[model samples]
Target: MIALLRGFLWLTGFWLAGESLVVLLDLPISAGVVGMLLLTIALLLRIGRLEDIAAASQPLIGLLAMLIMPGVVGVFFVADEFAGQWLAVAVALVGGTLASVLTTLLLMRRCMPAAPRTETPQETSS
Candidate 1:
């Protein structure tokens, strides 16, 4: 429980810091993204270990479907605007998914190649 609270507080602190930066610097990016960047930096700097936040974030990530429902509902409400552009939306979604998959495959191939296997020949019995 204490670990969960610490994680929540840590995440909140980073999020608030991000929002504060947005306010101060007038960045076009959203505060949540800035908070993510801060979190990444903190991890890379060894200041914030991922284990500290994993407990708190895991359950929240599981609730993603519920969390995203509102956005989905909003999209449904805007369906009228999208009705005429259905083909464009379909193409965009499919193209983006294919591009992302191909890019990930390419990166994995470059970054994580499989170990080579060596085969030995068997001697035939006389």
Candidate 2:
């Protein structure tokens, strides 16, 4: 219970700091996205531990599907515009997905250490 409160406070503090930095720099990026990125960096640096926030985050994470409701609803309003630009939308979707996948692969390759190769028993027999 205490850990959950601490986690919430930590997340809120980090988010406000990131948002303020974005506003101060006059960055075009969204504050929420910047906050999320900051949180990710903190986690990667071990400054924020998942376990510390797991309790509080668990319910919110579980209800994440509900959060998509607005996006799903918004899509209906854009359906006509999307249909008119289907080809461009398709291209953008594919390009964005590919770019995201490539970026993720590159980041993982750089951040994670490669596993040591192990010799098979048959090769040892030789």
Report the Cα lDDT for candidate 1: 0.85
Q: Could you tell me every candidate's TM-score relative to the true structure?
A: 0.69, 0.56
- State the TM-score for model 1: 0.69
- Reference-based TM-score, model 2: 0.56
In the range 55-123, model 1's lDDT, one tens digit per residue, is 778877899899989888787688787678988989999999999999999999899857444422333
lDDT minimum window of 10 residues, candidate 1: 117-126
Q: What lDDT would each prediction earn against the true structure? A: 0.85, 0.82
lDDT of 1 at 46: 85
* Displacement of the residue 49 alpha carbon in candidate 1, Å: 5.9
Cα deviation at 82, candidate 2, in Å, is: 4.3
Q: Model 2 Cα displacement at 9 (Å)?
A: 1.9
Q: For this target, which candidate reaches the highest lDDT against the unseen true structure?
A: 1
